[model samples]
Target: MVEKPGDSPHLLVVDDDERIRALLQKFLARNDFLVTTARDADHARRILSGLDFDLIVLDVMLPGDDGITLCGELRAHQTTPILLLTARAGTEDRISGLEAGADDYLPKPFEPKELLLRINSILRRMPAAEPGAGVPKVLHMGPLRYDIARGEMWRGAELVRLTATESQLLQIFSDQPGAPVSRADLVARLGRSGGQAQERAVDVQITRLRRKLEDDPKQPRYLQTVRGAGYMLAPD
Candidate 1:
């Protein structure tokens, strides 16, 4: 049996298929993960409220809200790595999945070994938790102040309530002040599963983040978009 990590890599498996869910949970647990199973997105959401997961395995097809929509919603607040599983193999379908904020996708009936490999790849590629460990780490942008280590955002002395995903996204940009982060790069860096659609969602979050931090959301100076490049958070 694979020994679990000290703070074991917590994985949430969201699938309606009992067979697949059970198999994945057992397989992943044997391979050293601390696995949690959810019958669907609703169940997963409940679990998400209480537990901090390192990664999420979500099925593309569900009874309601579909995996892609749920993934987009999750990305709006959290930067947890997501891997999408689908029975459809169409290029558009795959691209659509990526666009929804999935870090990676696997078609159904895949090899267990391949799934293991992909999971390992995502975990390995996850960004370092602390990019600026020793430097003056408080980020001051306009009226907002963010403590990257605590994953907390504040306006003056008042704490701003940010969803788990928002905090992670802010944590990424705050790490590199004034750096232009590409949409594609953000998708990759954040380990989102969807492709183009996911990038669009990122834009939405940036808009929301800007409104919260900027004096005027329409004319943003701190969070500027680079023409044909991506978004950058420049804090003074």
Candidate 2:
């Protein structure tokens, strides 16, 4: 049964086809998701600049910038999970989508139920901040400061903007300050299915995150990589 919309996940559906766009929005909205529709890549970018979404449902073939190229561009800055929809179902096409940074791919004419299941599964794997209650809310890492309660990161006096995925990763590391978190564990915690590809994707995210948190991303002091264990966060 499709879940009813309430305080549900927000999704951006990008497609050039007006009918498909409207249909998806209505269908996903009925299934307990906050749905936003965009005509094409440009429209999607404009909407994205103002609002945040939990996931993006992008159509591969569009009038303007293709979904694969757009997905790659977005992945450079945003870590929001993306599911690409394409008519092509070849192995190479699916791999190309993954290479472009899509979290999942769905061929056209797919069951709405399957889409709902995939969305729910991805959301379930995303890491969430644990209840701090009376515990310390502020974590200090040199000039970088993270507030667990607020899910905010600040550098010195400036507030840092983080994508949803980055925030989730920060919360995960902050929860266990100095302990190592294996790549496999991180993949699972981040709402991703286990695999070597996903592990590499996690590494990419960590690299991007380190650029924001560390003075020298090449030799990261705060987010360090353990030899065999995985990665650890050390806040001083």
Candidate 3:
């Protein structure tokens, strides 16, 4: 995304409907965000090419590339948080959206105030680099090194880009290294109200984190599932 000069947290709102797009733009702007609106996936892609946004509000039903398709595409290279809007509220659909790498999803006909709350929550979870006060504490797993204080990972000299959710998950795991943290606990730590969907969302975030941190995500080495206990970190 292109760089714009502003202190406000910028947001990209993507939807096919002009009315919804305009309404979200106005509402988000009123909430003190720098809002950019896109009619569909192509328009959103064009805008993203030049400007960087703090978060994306995407609609699952788009004309060309659907929101799930676009979310997966963008998540591959960028860690900007995405909150999807969809009419379908099925468990499978929500799981698919999370598996595709969306940060969160909202069923349509939702209150604007609720949408605002989700947006703000996602933005709040974003990790920021701090000025190092001393040598930062690090945890290692094979070739990767994670700075515990800053919530950053590095493979040799190159830094790994982590989504906000992944960073927060890592931070939580590092807090109680060898101890298993339950899915319910993870959901609570993530600022999500406890629900089956939220628990599934936690699992998806764990899988994504494992792909980045483990030599084999299918048979994880560092991040391990603890049977009925939950998940834990086994740092070497």
Candidate 4:
């Protein structure tokens, strides 16, 4: 069925490449998604201030505050899912994007259909966690408290920022607190492909989450690694 206006998911495409921006805008629009284009980070920020989008497709190499930096900054306020487009397909580059809070990363020169698939996949899991995944209204982690329903974590009245991926992971772990969630399961839940690289990316996200949930991220307390299993969130 054809979707009506305002019923389609809205997307913000931020890229310095004119051709890519126009191509994505047209292609995503044809797919029934409402698309907004931004030439660079500054422009994206300006557009973002006045608009809300379900997802953001951002280019890594932008004019100012490159996409990674911008993604980190955006995570501080909103939990909009972000899929990064980068020319650098190296593992390190991909890990950097994940660390910065991107929901997914797609290398440049990728097929449009693949991008569409990724977009749809991410949107399908936009709710963060599956229904019946129960947890306490507020899960305590030492000085930190996570409001499960709100998907928010706070430290002494100050709200702790989590990337969209990190927030989703928290909700998944919260759903089954004390139980170990395998890296493969985490990758699947995160809507990423299964592979050593994908699992490594999941680990990077867990490490990032630990930084926020632990006073000593080096030796985590609440979010713990359970060898032979995976990771277990042992909340206090």
Candidate 5:
């Protein structure tokens, strides 16, 4: 297994076609994603059962089970964003995918760059922060707690250990609360330049923090996105 970089976004690609699967995996990886490829829905399910992913790129047509059914199944348990790929271009097909818990859908014969953009958009919409204003230095949300000034996280009485990057990232979100904190702001707050590498690093830290704070890390409740603005930490 590749040791995922602390900053790279982890993505799972599910497709039956070997050519498309490999092509997408390599392309996404080159674009700063930590890509994992599965040959079919069964393979994807096995991988999903064992590891966590930030998003899934699932082809609507699979070997045995259809992607829409699998999408519904995944949405029932996880909040990770799903982007569906299909040969069908009908509005009804697109709507069905969205209704089945897909965050977005793309018809086949589309550009990979567009897929990348859509992926980023869906991830951006995921909880980057919770809602609150002028939140206290010590923030509480559900079972998780954080000491903003000290850069600490806690789940109930137990102290949760965070990597240095993770601590810094959480602090940035906690400070803003309901306000969206941009990627540039996050880079500057963490004392790094606003380069692609640093931005990717922020992603890694956010993923780690979500795993720690969210009841279901796959579906965050506290940290959410504010559209074009940036990430927000919404505390209870």
Candidate 6:
């Protein structure tokens, strides 16, 4: 059985073909995803500017600026996983998409179940929090309230959508509030092999987490980096 993350995973489907886009959105929704649609690259950019998605399903052939270019551009700033959709089934084409920062790729006229499996596979590779006890049920960070038990965050009454990785990071920090956790230690605890590459990946995940948790990511208050140490969660 496929493991469903705590909340419904949010997905953005970008395609120029109206019928394909609508069909994918409905089909993915039926599989327990919170689906959002974009007409093309420009529309996807517009929506992405304001909203955060767990994963993006982008069509390679678009009206303008294709998926490969968009995927490359997005990877520059965001670490959100992207899965490319293309009609071309050539091995080189699939390699190009992966080189452009897509986590996975699928050819046109494929089974929806295959796509679902790919998404789940990508998510299963992300870091997860280790089970522990004595952590507070609710942690206060300015106006944001994180419920550790439920694996949920809220800003006043509005629930914040967190990707699986982000949720795991938060849980890890909450487990040891006010204590520093070294990057290497974080890698070990999150079930990732210790290495420079994995450490850098942890940094990227931290940056993304800050965007959600901090009012100013550049000058973070809650999640702080100790100069020679590591990161500490200072919740009020």
Per-candidate local distance difference test: 0.78, 0.83, 0.89, 0.88, 0.76, 0.81
Q: Name the best candidate (by lDDT).
A: 3
- Lowest summed lDDT window (length 10), candidate 4: 127-136
lDDT of 3 by residue, 200-231 (tens): 88888899888898878999989999999999
Candidate 1 local lDDT, 1-236, one digit each (tens): 13477777988999999998889989999888998889888888899998888889999898878899999899777778888999997767876765666767888889988898888877765535455547646888867787777777778778785544456578778778798889888777656666776677577657667766788889888888888879888888
- Which sections of candidate 3 miss by over 4 Å? 1-5
TM-score of each: 0.62, 0.73, 0.95, 0.86, 0.56, 0.54
lDDT of 2 by residue, 58-132 (tens): 999988799999998998887688889999867677767766677677888899888888778767645465765
lDDT per residue for candidate 6 within 57-96, as digits (tens), equals: 9999988899999988997677688888999977667667
Put the candidates in TM-score order, highest first.
3, 4, 2, 1, 5, 6
Q: What overall lDDT, based on C-alpha atoms, would model 2 receive against the true structure?
A: 0.83
* Greater-TM-score candidate between 2 and 4: 4
lDDT of predicted model 1: 0.78
Model 6, runs deviating above 4 Å: 1-6, 131-236
Clashes of each: 17, 2, 6, 0, 15, 0
Reference-based lDDT, residue 126, model 2: 57
Question: Model 4: per-residue lDDT, tens digit, 58-141?
Answer: 999998789999998897778789999999979999998888788899998999999999999878655443356666488999
Task: List where candidate 5 sits over 4 angstroms from the true fold.
Answer: 1-4, 130-236
Q: Return the lDDT, model 2, position 22.
A: 78
Question: Model 3 lDDT vs. the true structure?
Answer: 0.89
